[model samples]
Target: MSIIAFSIAKIYSDSALNDENTFEETEKKFDKINNNDGIFEYKSDGFYLKQNKTREYIKWIEIESVIYFDYHILKNVNSTGIEISTSHKIYKIHNNDERSMGIEKFENELNKNINKNELYDSEVLSDGSSKTPLYIKSKI
Candidate 1:
């Protein structure tokens, strides 16, 4: 009876340990999918863009305008690109970049964070290019 009780207790303890490990692994996977993108990471406050050697962090409030354009590579092959103008600098993301498949998703997320008053879509030009003016703060 003593041996049987000890075996049952050991089995139960091992099962509990395995369950904990499984839960931890599942959580890690969820976090990876949630926070990571091809070339960006979406956060509660802002997003991070990973380039060749530098990682740029832009806050939602700093973005001034967003320009969406289609890059015509060939007669049939066209790619999408976005130019993000912020108070500090301008950043461009094209579909040709490595791990940049999340550009559209990033753009959508950005739209959700920016204020409607400040968010300006690009104006199309005669040559098919686009532009947007720098964000001017409202004087009240």
Candidate 2:
């Protein structure tokens, strides 16, 4: 059984930005336990259930602030994969199609605050590639 606690839930409510929305609803939190036989045991708030018995796709009742782990995020980015670095640790955002929009939204927020011109020189990288960093706009 693997347990992961995320700061927020990435919900896919739109398709224009690739069908995703990151909502900061903090009411439901739970753990997903997976058995060896490909059965998933979801435990949270006095709810215990099993999935993946008959079919590969399993659906559950929607909760206020719970998001499932999507593995497709890591697959579509590149062969080397997408590596996200935070202040605490490095995370490999895997490929889970549902979560793609949320991740991209978060990245956009971070990129907006970065000042590429001030941080790095105008020279290209060792691979002869130069990409400008993202700059975020402030509200105030």
Candidate 3:
């Protein structure tokens, strides 16, 4: 998960704008990533998984409040597969290093344009539970 987090952070850092258009641009970038070879595709309802040549999974997660750019490790699994579990939503993953590099580069740009503290913050969930804060420190 750290790799995914790092990857996401890298993407955000590369593209620093928080405007409404950012989401669309990110999606387009993700589309390019998914089309690359060596990346297997699987979908589950609204969830999608893209595995690299090593069979490790990188994900583009979309929930109600936020869109997550990350990857996860699948343990004790079988051969590579792609499955779609939902009808209303679609998800995908990209297996290309070039695409990942693009995301990383975009994140770098975002990091350069925005202040870490201003972009994200630690806060309590609606359930009244407090969560650990993630602070983005400036690399510039």
Highest TM-score: give the candidate number: 1
Q: TM-score ranking from best to worst?
A: 1, 2, 3
Per-model TM-score versus the true fold: 0.55, 0.25, 0.22
Ten residues in sequence with the least summed lDDT for candidate 2: 27-36
lDDT digits (tens) for residues 41-78 of candidate 1: 77888888887668899887777666676755565776
What is the C-alpha local distance difference test score of candidate 2? 0.28
Q: Please list the residue runs of candidate 3 whose C-alpha ends up more than 4 Å from where it truly belongs after superposition.
A: 1-70, 76-97, 118-140
Error of 3 at 4 (Å): 39
Per-residue lDDT of 125 in model 2: 45
In the range 5-98, model 2's lDDT, one tens digit per residue, is 2322222322223322313222111111111222222233222222222312212222111211222224353211133333333344333333
* Alpha-carbon RMSD of each model: 12.2, 18.8, 17.8
Candidate 1 residue 131 Cα shift, in angstroms, is 6.1
Judging by lDDT, tell me the better candidate of 1 and 3: 1
lDDT of each: 0.68, 0.28, 0.37
